[model samples]
Target: MNILLWHVHGSWTTAFVQGPHTYLVPVTPDRGPDGRGRAETFTWPSSVREVTPAELAAAPVDLVVLQRPHEERLAAEWLGGRRPGRDVPAVYLEHNTPRGDVPDSRHPAADRPDLTLVHVTHFNRLFWDNGSTRTAVIEHGVVDPGHLYTGRLPRAAVVVNEPVRRRRYVGTDLLPGLSEAVPLDVFGMRTEGLAEELGLPADRCRSADLPQRQLHAAMAERRLYLHPVRWTSLGLSLLEAMHLGMPVVVLATTEAVEAVPAGTGVLSTRPEELARAARRYLADPEAAARDGARARQAALERYGLKRFLDDWERLITEVRS
Candidate 1:
């Protein structure tokens, strides 16, 4: 299948293009948000090809995978005014949870019966009002980072992009308290001033914007992975960390409750409880490693790339047919 999709989320796309299909990604001169072309940080297979606006306009697209709401209009313009889902097969992949009016939050494509709304988590599917639009929950799948856990460093590791800006939503507010239990090594974009903003010393809450490989390597050295996000469809970073064989301490919100099962690590709604769990993991390397192994196994069984790609293949075939 010739799948037309934008490079919206890098990590998710990295695993997606590994499937048995020709992925057509958009490329602009600037390679901006709508047209990131190919991923630089993560490796992709030859099946993923970059198509310019003019090229896409003429190319035959088997299925259109829409991530952002604006992509519907963008796809029409790029496809020479072909209406997605109506003129061509299309699916709207909702990555984030609804923002306003929890119960009444209607999806933008809710009224479109021709399009299928794909939610990354069951929580998102339950929360979103799809109206007459068809919906499916595919969950999340990640390319395994391998069993890289060393737990050599006695600190905790966190991967939250723009932690300072997202604040409590990304669980940045819980970091300071967790830092009291175990020092945190933060990694992601726009996290440079996080230490100062959180009123913590530089050593306690150090931040770096390492590439994906380096980030995984650095995170593996830590005693445990910290996922404090209060609300999200599901975080790919959390799954990636588990695949890296790092024991996690996550806030039991959104889809995290399903991702981080009991005995894999600690899952708590209380910040203090999660902090205490982090401290325990930091203190006991053997315990951390035991849980980390469970985490790796669970991640592979639930979020493996093969299953993800298979699900997508079936969905695309059904939609296209």
Candidate 2:
């Protein structure tokens, strides 16, 4: 089967490409680090021709897998007329929270009668009405060894794209309180408002997007990781942190409640409780280490790349059936 995967999640491309069938990834015009545009146009597995009304019209695409409405307009272009392998299925992977009062069944992608929706977390699955949508839950998975060597560290960290809405989801405001008791680092796309408003010391806030090695290195720098999400669904970042042997101090909302077990970290409703748990991890490093070890064990057992691939294959085959 030739699948046209958008390859938006750069880190997961390896696993998807190595699966049972060939994957046709869309080429980007920007020839950056990720396999974007180049004159020659490299192809492996299979390269679905660059997305255009006419070019995509000719490609023998079996399925179009998307994570969101990012490519809705471009994808809609090739909706008409079929050649041979033309009337392919479309799959949308829901990777985050539902928008507004609208349910997943109302997703723009689901407007296509041939489209199937896949959710990455059960927390997200519940948000869908599923009246007009074929919904399936395929939780995020990670690739890990049987047991990982966890290093001891002093502080705790949380990863997020926007750091300013500190009080909102990702608990940006919690960081200042967290850093007061225990040192914390925020990694990923940073916002100036968060940086200016929160005024966490230079050591506390940053706008750094590190490589995989550096990301793991950042995780290894702390004994525990704080999730503290208030709005969004379970973030892939939390699972990555768990895989890195970091026990989390997260809010008991969304999938974090299910993702992090009692043995893994502390979950609570209020920010004060979260702050207390942060202190517990900070004061009792030994306990945090043990929790992290358990978290790593849980993460490896539940979320693995091979598992995700198998789940995806089953969904695709089920749609075929």
Candidate 3:
């Protein structure tokens, strides 16, 4: 099938285009948010092609996979007034936890009968009030970076884009205290000045935005992966970290509880408890290795690439039919 989706979330899209289908990504001159084209940092298959909006207007689009709210309108404009779900079969893939109202937030696509709402996590599906919009849960899948864990660095590995801007939302504020307990190597975009901003020594709170493969390798070297996001649909990095054979120290929030099963790693609501867990893992490489093995196994069983692709295939077929 020919799928039309934006290059919105790089990691998620990287896993997505690996499926057995031709993916049409929109490209603009600037390659801005609206039309960022195909991924450059992460290796995507040849099946994923970038086409201009003018080309997309006449291109064969079997199914439109909408990630952001504006994509619906953009799709119509680009398709020469052919709206998604109405003129083309489309599904809005909600990758975020609602922002404005805690649990009372209504999804923008709520009560819309035209398209289906596909959520990456059950927690997102549960929290979002879809009203009459048909909804389905298709959990995240990542292209396995393999079990590259060494755990030589006794520091905690963290992956979050724009930590300073997102701050508490992505658990950037929790890093200072966690760093005091165990050294943190925070990674992702705009992470360069994080150490100075957080008022920590460069070694205690190191930050860098590396390419995907480099990021995975760097993350594998750390003693454990730290996922302190207060609210999110589900972070694919957490799954990728587990796939790298890294024990996780995740905050029990959003879809993390469902993602991180017992024996995989430590899950806590309290920061102090998580900090203590991080310290324990740093102290005991044996325990960390043992739990990391369990984490890799669990991640493989649930979030494998094959399963992810198969689930998407099933949904695309259903949506198209």
Of 1 and 3, the candidate ahead on lDDT is 3
Which model scores highest in lDDT? 3
Reference-based TM-score of each model: 0.98, 0.82, 0.98
Candidate 3 local lDDT, 129-169, one digit each (tens): 88999999999998999989999999999998899999989
Query: What digit string (tens of lDDT, one per residue) describes model 2 on residues 1-321?
Result: 776656566444544555677565555456442234212312224333344345566666667677657555455555345421135566777776766684534555454556677887887878765456678888876645233325466666777776664457667756677677666666665554454577767666544556554676777667677776777867777887888777788878888878888888888887778778877877787887788888887887788777888988888887766
Q: Judging by TM-score, tell me the better candidate of 2 and 3.
A: 3
Which 10-residue window of candidate 2 scores lowest in summed lDDT? 34-43
The collision pairs in model 2 are 142-303, 142-304, 164-194, 166-172, 166-173, 167-173
Q: Please list the C-alpha lDDT of all candidates, in the order they appear.
A: 0.91, 0.66, 0.92
Tell me the lDDT of model 2 at 16. 57
**Candidate 3 ranges with C-alpha deviation above 4 Å:** none
Q: What shift in Å separates residue 107 of candidate 3 from its native position after superposition? A: 0.7
Candidate 2 to native Cα RMSD, angstroms: 4.4
> For candidate 1, lDDT tens digit of each residue in 118-189?
999999989988899889989788988899999999999999999988997899988888899999999998
